[model samples]
Target: MKALKPRRFGWWYVAEWRLRGMRSYRWTILLMTLGNPVLYLAAMGIGLGALVRVDVAGVSYLHFVAPALLVSTTVAEGFNEASWPVMSGFRWQKFYLGMSATPLAPVQLAMGESVAVSLRLWVQSFTFWLIGLAFGAFDGLVSILIVPIAVGAAMATHAVVMAYVATIDNDVVMTFMYRMIMMPMFLFAGTFYPLETMPVFLQWIGWISPMWHGSQLARVVAIGLPEPGWLIACHVGFLAVWTIGGLLWARRTFTKRVVV
Candidate 1:
C-alpha cells in the first residue's frame, strides 16, 4: 500500500473569508483600534501618570504602564476573538455549521480566527506603542524592536486562551473563566507597578502570566535595559511553546467539534 500522506492544516481559506468579511468594518476597526488608545493615553498616561511619578521600575509612570498595557490588551483582544466572535460564528451566525458543510474544516476556522485575532492584537498594540511614543513613553528605538516580540507574546497568549475557548461546548463556562481568571491576571501582571513590590505570594501570578513574561521582555527591548539572557530566553521560549502547541490542539479539537 502507498504511504499515507500527512494531513495538512488548511486554514488559509478560512483566513481569507474572515478577512474578506472584515473589510466592510475595516474603517470602524481602524478607528476603534487607533482612537481608543488616544483616549487611554489622554486619560491614563497623562491623567494618571501625572498623579504618580516616583518611577516603579526606574521608568516614568507612563512608560511603566505602556508595556503592561501592551501585553494585557493583546491577551484581551486575542480572547475577544476566541470568545465572542467565535461564539457568534457557532451560535448567532451559525457560520461554522455552514462551513462544516463545505470542505473547510473546523480547525481551519478556529485557526483562521486566531490568526485574525493576532492581527487585531497587532493593530491594538502597535497603535498603543505609537501613541505612547508621541506621549514620550516609548523611551527610544530599542523600545521599537520589542514590537514584534510583544506581538509574539500576544500571539502566544492568544494560543492558550483560544485553545481553552475551542474546548468549550457552550459559552457560559468561558465567560466565567474570563472574569475569574483573565481579569485578575490583567490587573496584577505588572501593569501599574513592578512585580517586585507585590507580596511574595501574589508575585506568583505575574511569574506565570504570559503578559508579565512579555512585559518584562518588552521593557528590556523598549527601554534599552539589560536583562538576564537566560531569563529572556526562557520567557520567550515558553510563550512560543504555548503558541505552537495551542495552535495544534485548538485545530484538532475544533476539527473534531465541527464534525459532531
Candidate 2:
C-alpha cells in the first residue's frame, strides 16, 4: 500500500481516531440515543399533554413542545460532546499533545473532532424525529426537517462550547457552565413555553440561545408555526454565524494550546 499521506487528509485521520474511540462506549450512546426520546415523548407528549387541553402556539401542546424538545435534546448532547471530550484531549488523556507530535495540525484535529460530533448529533436528532412521529407529535412530512434543524443547532452549540473548552485547564469552569449556562438556557429558551410568556427581562435568554433559534425553525417546519419570513431568515443567519465563528475560534484556540 502507498504510504498514507497525513498532510493531505489529516482531518479525516483525526476524525477516524475519535470515531473509533467512541466504540468503547457504543452501548451507552445507543441507549441514550434511543431511550431519551421515548421517555421524554411519553412523559411530556402523552402524560403531561393530557392536562394541557388548550392549544399552545396554535397547536396541541404536545405538537408545540415536541420540536422544542427535539432541538433541546440535541443541543444538550452537543454541549456534552464538546465539553469533557475536549478537556480529556488536552488535560486528562493528553491525546491532543500526542497528535501534535505527529504531522497532524491543531486545526485538523479541531475539524476532525467537530466532524465526529456533528455526525453524532445528526444521528441523535434523526432518532428523536422518528420517535416524535410515533407519538403523533408532528404535523406532516415537513416535520422531518426538524432533524437537520436540530443538527445545525447542535453543531453550532458544539462549536461554541468546544471553543471555550479548548481554553480551559480544569473542570471548574465546565461545572459552572452546566449549572449556570446550560440549565438556564434549557429552561428559558422557549423549550417548554413561548418566550413571550416569560418575564420581559428573562426573555433575552431565548434571543441569544441556539436552542431557541433551532426550536423556532423546527416548529415552523414541524407544525407550521406562524413566523414571518424575516424572522426565519434571522434564525438561519444566527446559527450560521455561530457555527462558522465558533469553528474559527476553536481552531485558533486549539493551535495556541496544542501547537505550543
Give the worst 10-residue stretch by lDDT in candidate 2. Answer: 1-10
Kindly report which residue stretches of model 1 are placed more than 4 angstroms away from their true locations once superposed.
1-9, 24-28
lDDT of 1 by residue, 26-138 (tens): 89778867876677667777799899968756777777777666666666666666676666676678788888886666767777777666676677778877877887877
Candidate 1 global TM-score: 0.88
Tens digits of lDDT, candidate 2, 1-260: 33368877899898899889999989989998999899888888888889999999889989989999999999999999999999999999999999998888888998998898888878888888888898888768888999999999999999989998999988999999999989999999999889999999999999999999999999999878889999999999999999999999999999999866
How does residue 252 of candidate 2 score in lDDT? Answer: 93
The worst-scoring run of ten residues by lDDT in candidate 1 lies at 1-10
How far in Å is the alpha carbon of 111 misplaced in model 1? Answer: 2.6
Q: What's the residue-level lDDT of 251 in candidate 2?
A: 90
**Each candidate: RMSD to true structure?**
3.3, 1.7
